[model samples]
Target chain A: MRDLLRILSRFWRASLAAELEYRVNFVFSTLNAALGLVLGLFALSLFFQNGHAFDGWSFDASLVVYGLFTTFSGISSVLFVPNLSRVVEHVDKGTMDFVLLKPVDSQLFVSTRNFSPWGLPDIALGLGVIGYAARRLDVDPGHVPAALLAALLSLIILYSLWFALASTSIWFVKVYNATEVLRGLLDAGRLPIAAYPAGYRVFFTYVVPVAFLTSVPADVLRGADATSWLAIEVVVAVLAFGLSRAFWRLSLRSYTSASS
Target chain B: MTFLRRARAFLEVYYAYMLVYRSELLLWALAMSLPFISMGAWIKAADTGAFPLAPVEFGRYFLVVYLVRQLTVVWVVWEFEYDIVQGRLSPRLLQPADPVWHYVGGHVAERAARLPFTVVIVAFFFMLYPEAWFVPSWTETVACLALSLLAWVLRFVLQYAFAMAAFWTEKASSIEGLWQIGFLFLSGVVAPLAVFPEAVREVVLYTPFPYLIDVPVRALLGAPITLRDVLIPGAWLLVALVAQRLAWRAGLARYSSMGA
Candidate 1:
């Protein structure tokens, strides 16, 4: 626990320093994120304009899904996008040698080191949407703490899924393009799972876990109370993380530096 | 050798590169089918007779959106940003043909090679929804195709100009993200601009982004096409072309190649 905290502190400090170097970009990103937040909310309004229920979910219910999507996606942008790009860099430069020399887990370090400090703007905006939606839905403040917890757990599952995909760069250098593939799947989060057909809902919820990132938490927020879903999320996350670790280790064993 | 001869030689070589990566090309084309997936969900919901657009109408709208997305999607921003930053642009500049034109040729060539796959996918989707074909009148089809091509060029030039910002700033990645968020909302990738509130839709149409996706898509689907419709999107494309020219001229002068 202490070691993990130390690493996280160091990572945060590095990100802060890097972000501080480009203050104007940070401000622009914040404004950009806020604009996206407004657009997301407005989109919901437009959908509700036509009628009330969309795929059996109320406007407020779908709003929770959108809110959770922004929150988890913010977590992803903050953690994964920055780090996943480095996988491509490492592959291009044959820099796996440096990673292998580390005493600690190379995959962990690589996956965690590319933190961007400015992504919190999206997180804050997501909270504002969720709060507004909660008011509109008449959700109890007592449920807020549970929603936050679910969001964190959901974020964990999301991070693991991304890391597993990024680790594929060890064997398939071209897999960097897969990040966009992942983003395409994540885009499904914009709507609630209840809005999709049965096959799609099943595919997203279990097969890919795309729905878990937002829909499940939103369902809980709407009083569906699927806490068992969180347990499944934690299990999937751990399994995914382990698979990535194994892959990284096996690839390192065959690393044979890209000297050519 | 003559300029046309050299151009032919370059085209031949570029074609070979694309053939080698044909699988990746197919995947890239398939990746653009997110709109189709969304269409499925919406159509299924509309099938229940509860939503605004009927299943057939929803199919027509989303199919158009899918095609427009393919026409307007630009990965060149990242490609150009890398070339400029890594000094690859310097070597290209030494070539007889203008580097930008050469880059555009290569980009177009890749798209041309993939055209068959794109057509097949579109045909397959259309077959899957024969009732929702929205078969355009021949004149409307020709006009829509023309505007779609213009939208394609507008998107490419705008993104290429945005990518050239590497000459002035180190945070091109963040800038790209900002651009994407803007494109997502303004280009109607998240939802149709028609779905947006009236005031918001009015303001967004004044910008060039919508021409890149929404206008061409709506036009192709046989949605309210008029001389005024053509004029508005045409004006935006013209303005983009002018801005692109200015930005490219300025950016080329300031470009410090990677060797330095």
Candidate 2:
């Protein structure tokens, strides 16, 4: 764990230096992320314009979900997305040989090799929105621990899901589309799960488990019982990660260097 | 070669290219379906007297929004940014044809290929809510189709213009992202413009953003579309064309001056 942390720190330093080479990008990305937050809030306001509550979610609850979605997406963009999406290119070009030859765990190295420091603005904006929403909802401080736990579980599940998809690049060679699928599923997280039709609700809640990503955390913030959902999230995260790791190992055995 | 012949060749090449990337195109189409998330919220609100729309009406509007979205979405900014940054634009610059035409041809061909998928989605939606499906008059259908084509053109030009910012900065996609946030609210992607405050709606109607998605969608849904609605987008199209030409010329000058 310490070695992983040290390697991540080194990677992050390099990423920061690379990003800082373009100062204008810092300004534009910050503005872009801020605009994303504004759009999320604007959408929520539009929904509340028709009613105070949507399905069973109060405005504040929905805002919490929106905030969590932004935060999760920001993290994904910064960490998992940039790294996992590269698996397709690596597999296509036979660059995975180098990744496999690395001294550290291949999955760890592959998943944390790059970071986008610009994505921090989105995370900051998301936390701000979440704090603002919590204030409006008068959320109990007692629930903060549970919400954080759920958030961690959500991240784990999402990472595992992305890992599994990225591993398929070994066979499919075009599995970068998996990132788009992940993105589409995350968009569904913008709304409370209850708002969806029965079939969609089931699909999102169980099949993809996107409902656990944002809505469950937001539900915890809203003082709802999230214990059952948290349990499911933990189980899903473990199963997903184990299966994905096994798949990655199995796929690696089939990989032939492009040069060969 | 004549413009028509050159365009035909480009179309054939890009159609084959798009066929190879059909999964990616389908993934993008799925990613752009954010309207479904909003649809769920609005449908629930409608059931509870929060929204003026009946659940079926919300269903129909969002279903149409989905189709319009698929038809109008543009990724030229990302494509151009990639070309500029990766030095790929240099070879294209030597070609007699404007590289922008390549992008236009690719997008148009992809859309053509995507028609069957769109029809499948529409059919599935209609199956779920047959009562919500409304076929407009033949005249209205013709008008909607024309406006939708215009909308696609405007979106393509606008995004191409935005992508030209790559000549000045590395973060042109950030600008595109910001522009998309504006479109999300102003283009009636999140909700019908009728649901917005009247003053905001009036101002939004005057902007080019609405022409990108809203006007065509409203027209397709058999909603009232005034002469001004048509005229505004027509004027915007002319403006966009001029702007695109200027930006392209200036961007190419900068690119050459930098010896890239």
Candidate 3:
């Protein structure tokens, strides 16, 4: 595990240097991320115009959900998605064979290859949004530790979700936009999960795992009921990780390229 | 006759390509359906009185929104950016046909091929919400339909200009993300502008994003729309077109593609 951390740190440095060569892009990306936050705020404000609260949650609660989803999405995009998008390219160009031949796990290398340091702006902006939304909701600082734990779990679920979705690309070469679909599904998290019909809320929470990514963290931040779901979240995260690992290995068996 | 001949030849090639990769087109269309799902959620929310929105109104509004998105969303910018990065743009530029015309032809052809799928979605909306298809006045519906066409043209041109930034910038994906966020909030994909703050809605009225989707959707769903409403969106369409031209001209000079 320490060696893995050392390797990731080296890869991260390499990625930063490569990205820094095009510095203006960093500014544009920051601006782009800021625009996403602005849009989320605007959407929340629009929803609030219709009612003081949607379903049982106040506008502040919804914003917390949006912010949490944004934070998770931003981190996922920063750390995992860029590498995931490149999976097709590597496969098409036969560069994936190199990854398979590496001493480390091919999945690990492929999953961490394209870390973008510039996406840190999104993380900062998302956290700021979450902080502001928490303040609006009058959330207590005493709950900060729990909220952080929920947020970390949410990030794990999100990362695992991406892994599961992206692993399909190894088998289905046509699935270039699966990550976008995942992103869009995450966008569903921008709204308060409780605002959805009970059936959808249940599905999102249990089946799809969106609730863990947005609602649970938001609820924890709001001092709402989240403890009951914490154990379920952990179980789901572990299951998701196991399933994705299985899928990744299955895909590898069918991979045409060989180290030879 | 000469123009028709060229158009036919271009469309033939385009259709052939579409047939070969038809699944990709279907996937793209399916990927775009998340907004419809959000609209569905809003409709149900309205049914439960979660918001002031009437269920039928929400249905009508979102159907129009989905259709407008189909017409207005442009993929040119990202396509150019990818082509540039992959070193394919240079060869395309060397072709006898102007690259812009080729792209326009490609987009037009893709739109044509996808028409069946778009119509199926519209038909589903019609079946589910007959009230949304209600036409109080034929003249109004016709005028709105015309405006919708104009809006799509302007939207495509606007996005093409932005996409042209790939000629200079390495972060066109970030630029596209910013535009998408703007579209989500300002363009009425999240909800109708009527749901936004008066001041915010008023400011957005001046921007091109609303005309891209919201205005046309409103005009279509609220058929028998006033002459003034019809004219405002038309005027914005003209402005968008002009803005697109200026941006395109400025961007073209900076484009070096992969060779440079």
Candidate 4:
């Protein structure tokens, strides 16, 4: 564990130093994220026009969901996208041989290899929005930890799904767009599950599992009695993580490297 | 080579190349599924409350939005930057014809490949929710298709202009990211322009963004539209064409190959 931590820090620092060489990207990403937040707010406001709402979700409540989605988008760019995209490149180039040759677990190394600080602005903005929404809702301080726990579970579910998609590259070598489709579908989480129609509610909840990623966490954040939902989120996260692990192992078994 | 012959060769070769990536293209088509998800929310809102567009109309509108989005999508900035950064632009530059035509050919061919996938998804979606289906007059269909093509051209030229930044910076694609935020929100990708506040919609219509997605969607859905809808985007296209021309000349003047 300590060795992994050292390795993680080392990789992050190296990438950070290299990325700093192009400081202009930081400015561009900040601007991009800020503009994106404005657009999201505008879209949310459209749903609330004339005292209407997304199903029963007030604008403020949905903002919490949007905030979580933004926060996770930043986390995705920082962790999931950078690493998982490299997974495809490495597999395509028959470079997975080198990854397996390393002393550490290949999955760990592939999953935690690089960090992009560009998502920092998005992360900060998301937290700011979340705080603002929570204040508006007058959320109880005691339930904040419950929200955090649900969000942590949400992260686990999200990472597992992304990793599983990336791992398919070992067999298909071009599943990059599969992950793109996943990210696109996950955009549904920007609103509460209840906002969608019955069929779509089932599709997102079971097929894509988007509900646990944002809506459930938002519900918890606003102090809704959502313990049952949180429990379901816990189970879903665990199953997703385990399934991803098994899938990666199976995929690796089929991976025939050109290098060796 | 003559102009007609050169265009023929580009399209044929690139079409074959795109056909080879058929499955990849399918995944890319699926990556734009956000409209379907949003359609569910809009339909729900229309069902549960008073809204500008009816429930069936919201369904029809968002489906058309998805179709227009697929038809008008552009990724020239990323491809152009790659050519510049990797110095692959040299051989194309050495050719008698301009290199921009190469990227344009690829985009057109990719769009051709995407058409079948788009049709399949639309067919399947209508199968599941037949209530969203609508039939429009031939004139409206033709006009919508024309505007969709025009939107594609305008977006391509604008992005190609931004792609010129690769001459000075390695991260030209970041500009695409920023541009997409505006494209997603202002272009009515999130919801129909009818749902937007009248004043905001009026202001947004003045911009090129809504002309790209909303205008075509409205036209296809048999909503009231004037020649002004077509005129605004046509004017923007001319402006973008000039900008693209200036940027290409400047970028070519400053261009240096990777190992040069």
* Best by the lDDT measure: 4
Of candidate 2 chain A, the 10-residue stretch with the lowest lDDT total is: A47-56
Q: Report the first chain's TM-score for all candidates.
A: 0.89, 0.94, 0.92, 0.98
Model 4 has an lDDT value of 0.89
Candidate 2 per-residue lDDT over residues A164-221, each given as its tens digit: 8888888888876667767776788877887677777888988888898898889887
Instruction: Provide the global lDDT of candidate 1 against the true structure.
Output: 0.74
On a 0 to 1 DockQ scale, where is model 3? 0.50
Each candidate: what lDDT?
Answer: 0.74, 0.82, 0.74, 0.89
lDDT of 3 by residue, B82-122 (tens): 87778777787677766677677777788777778888877
Candidate 3 lDDT score at position B213: 76
Per-candidate DockQ values are: 0.45, 0.61, 0.50, 0.84
Candidate 1 lDDT score at position A192: 82
Point out the higher-scoring one by lDDT: 2 or 4: 4
> Is model 4 an incorrect, acceptable, medium or high docking prediction?
high
Model 2, span B144-234: residue lDDT tens? 7888888888888888888888888877888888787788777878788777778878888888888877788778777777898779988
Q: Write the per-residue lDDT of candidate 4 for residues A1-260, one digit (tens) a residue.
A: 79978999998998888879899998999999999999899888877766778765788899999999999999999899999999999999988899999998888999998888999999999999999999999999999999999999999999999999999998899887898899899999888898988998898899989999999999998888899999999999999999999999999999999877
Off by over 4 Å in 4: B258-260
Candidate 1 residue-wise lDDT at A126: 84
Off by over 4 Å in 2: B257-260
Tens-place lDDT digits, model 1, residues A1-260: 89988998898788878768888866876888888887667755655664546765787888878877887777777888888888767876888678767876787788888788667888788877888888898887666777667777677777777877777777667765577677777778888877777777888888878777787777667667678886776677677667767777776666667764
- Chain B TM-scores, listed for every candidate in order, come to 0.85, 0.93, 0.82, 0.96
Q: Provide the TM-score for each candidate, comma-separated.
A: 0.89, 0.94, 0.90, 0.97
Docking class of 3: medium
